[model samples]
Target: MNTIVQASPVTEKSRQLVTVATPENAQYLTFLLGGEMFAVGILHVKEIIEFGNLTEIPMMPAFIRGVINLRGAVVPVIDLAARFAGEPSQPGKRTCIVIVEVQDGDLSHDVGIMVDAVSEVLEIPANEIEPPPSFGARIRADFIQGMGKVAGRFVILLNIHRVLSVDEIATLAGVATPGEGVAHRSGS
Candidate 1:
C-alpha cells in the first residue's frame, strides 16, 4: 500500500517567524503503544474515550477488536498494536480509544483506534522531525509520517488516515451485520 506523508510546508515568511513562534510545528496527540510513545496529528483526533465494552465482529481481521457505540454511532475500533505490529493487545488501566476522522475517497468517516494510553498533546517543531527511516522501523514505515524527537526520545508520528484505511476494516459493517462476532466484552 502507498502511504502518503504530508510534509509541513515552509515559506520564507514562515521561516523568519520560526525563530520565535515556530510556525512549522504541528500539534500532535501523543499516546503510548507497547512501551514506546507515538503521535498522530491533532487534526485527526476527535475525542478520547476510556476503554469500554466492544461488540465483536466475526470473521474479521484479528486487528479489528470490534465496534463501540459513540453517541449512537457505531464506530469500528482497531487494535493499533495488532494492526501494525501483528501482536495481540493486553489491556491495562491506561488503555483507551481515540476517535478520529479519516477520509476515504470523498467520504469522511469516524473510526476508533485503541492505544495503550492517551498522553499529552504536543507541538513538535518541524526541525526536530525527521523523515521516516527507510529501514529499522519496527512497523511498516508507510504508516509513519516521520519521527519526532521529544524529551530526547523518538516518537513515531503516525498518518492516522492511512493507518486505518485498510479495505477490509472499511467494509466490515457493510458486509456483516452487527453482533456477528464474539460476545461483547466489558472493557478493553
Candidate 2:
C-alpha cells in the first residue's frame, strides 16, 4: 500500500519539523517576518511572486504599501510588519510577496503580503496544533489561527481571513470603491 503524504505547518529553525498524528492533516506555507516565523493555510495561497513594480498610492496607510500589476490584476500589497504595528519592512534580498485570496461578502479579492522570505511547506497533523493564546504574541491575538509545534519550536499559524479582511482593511484605510478611489495620473 502506498502511504499518503500530506503537508502541515512548519517553520525552518535550522531545518526541523514537528507534528502529531490525527485523523485529518493540513498544509501551511511558512514565511518570515521580522525574524519570526508565520504560516498560512495553503488553500488561501494563490501564488508567490518576486516583489517589484509597486505603484504607491497616495494617502493610504503605511501597511498598504501599494498595488502590483499581477497579470493585469491590480492586487494590493500589504506590509505585514506595518500591519502588525511595527516599522515598515525594508525589502531585503530574499523579499517576496505571497498572494492570497480573501472573500468579501459574495466577492473574492486577491491580496499580497510581503515577507522577508518563503519557507518550505509542511504537512501538519491536527493533533499537534494548539489554540491561540490570549496574549504574548507579537501581533494581535485575534489574528492567530493556532500554534503549530515544529521540532520542539512553534510556528504562528495565522488566521488569514481575519488578518486580511478586505472590508476591515478598506474601511480602516479610508479607501473608497474602485471607481471612486484612484484618480488617473496622466503622463506621470
Candidate 3:
C-alpha cells in the first residue's frame, strides 16, 4: 500500500498513439457496478477470484471493505461502490474480486476491487472514447478515464490509479492505525 504510481502504463499492444478516428485500439476489462457498466484498462488487471472471507480492519474508511491474504501477501479489498461514496455493495452470485496491480512510486502492489460481475474484455477504438465530463458524474471526475462508446451505448472508463491512489488511502490507514493520533472521522 506504500507503493507510488506516476501514471498508468499502457500495454505494448495498446501503445499506438490515438488521434481522431485513427483506428488505434485499447483493451478494457468491463464490469458491472450499481447497474452501470464500467471498465478498466486490461493492462491493470491481474486475475479474477471468487468473493470470500475478508479480515476487516477497524477504523478504516468505509470504502475499504477489508484485507485478504493472497499467497502470504496482505492485499486490501475495496468496495468500489462505497469508494465512489455510494452504498455498500452486497455480493451476489456473480460477485467476484478483481486483482489488479497498481503502481505506486517504483513498486507495484496488488489490490482487490469488488465488482458485481465481470463482463468481458473489449477492444475499443480511440476515436470512440470521449474525455471525462467535468460534472454530473456519479463518481469523482478524476476517477473517470473517459466515456467509451460501445454498441451505441456509453461505458464509463475508470482511471483505476486515481481511484486506488495509495497516498490517499494511506491517509485513511493512518487515521485508523493506533498511535497515529488521528481520530476516525465519521458521518451519517
Candidate 4:
C-alpha cells in the first residue's frame, strides 16, 4: 500500500513574510564627561590616546588644556567638562584624548578633546532619537543635536560643528594675546 503525506498549507499572513526592516542606525563614538554620556559622529574621530603630559600654552582659555605633539603635528586639547560645564577636569585611568578634525575659519585643524572615559561605539536607530530639550540639558541646547535613548537612559548627542566651532576656539585662544606674560597667567 502506498501512503500519501500531506504538507501543512501556508497561510496568507505567513506567506506575506513579515520583514522587520532593520532601522537605519547611526554609529557614534560615545564618551563620558562628568557623569553623563555624550557621543560624537564616528566620522570625525581620528583616534583615541591615553592621557599624558601636555605642553601648556599661555594666555589661552582655561578649557584649552594646551597642545600636544602628535606625529609632528601640534594639536590643542580641550577639556570637554571644562569647556561645556565650566568645571575642572579630574582625569583618571579612563581619561583619554580623542583626536578630531575641526574647521576654524579657512583652516581645518586637528584638535584633541579630553574625556573622562571612552565608551564603546553605539549604533542608535534614528527613531530612538529625540530632539534636544530646551531646558533640561546641562549644557547649552544649541550644542546638542538631540538626546539618544540608550539602555533606558539618554545619551547627549553633540553637534560637533557647533560645540567645537573654530570661531569660539579661536576667541578663547585669542584671550591670551601675544607677549604680556601669557605663560604666567596660564600657569605654564
- Whose TM-score is greatest here? 2
Ranked by TM-score, the better of candidates 1 and 3 is: 3
Q: What's the CA error at residue 141 for candidate 3, in Å?
A: 0.3
What shift in Å separates residue 94 of candidate 4 from its native position after superposition?
A: 1.0
Ranking by lDDT: 3, 2, 4, 1
Q: How are the candidates ranked when ordered by TM-score, highest leading?
A: 2, 3, 4, 1
Question: How well is each residue in 104-183 modelled by candidate 2, as lDDT tens digits?
Answer: 77778899999999897777789899999998888999999999998988999999989998778877677654445643
Off by over 4 Å in 2: 1-23, 177-188
Native-vs-model 3 lDDT? Answer: 0.81
Candidate 2: worst-modelled 10 consecutive residues by lDDT: 1-10
Model 2 global lDDT (CA atoms, 0 to 1)? 0.80
Cα shift from native, residue 146, model 3 (Å): 0.4
Give the clashing residue pairs of candidate 2, or none: 7-122, 7-123, 7-124, 8-122, 8-123, 8-124
Candidate 4 per-residue C-alpha lDDT over 6-101 given as tens digits, one digit per residue, 9 for 90 to 100: 222455532322223234747788888998999987767767777776887766677899878777677788998988888879889898888888
lDDT (10s digit) by residue, model 1, range 1-188? 12222222454522332232235758788899988899988777777777767887666667888878776677888999998888979889888888888886676778889999887878899999999999988888888999999988999999776788745454532343333553333333
- The C-alpha stretches of model 1 lying farther than 4 A from their native spots are 1-23, 166-188
lDDT tens digits by residue: candidate 3, 1-188: 33221222455422432212224658888999999999988878877777877888777768888888776777899999989965889999998888898988787889999999988878898989999999999999999999999999999999999999877887756553323466556662
TM-scores vs. true structure, each candidate: 0.77, 0.82, 0.80, 0.78
RMSD of candidate 2 to the truth, in angstroms, is: 9.4
Give per-candidate clash totals. Answer: 1, 6, 5, 0
- Clash count for candidate 2 is 6
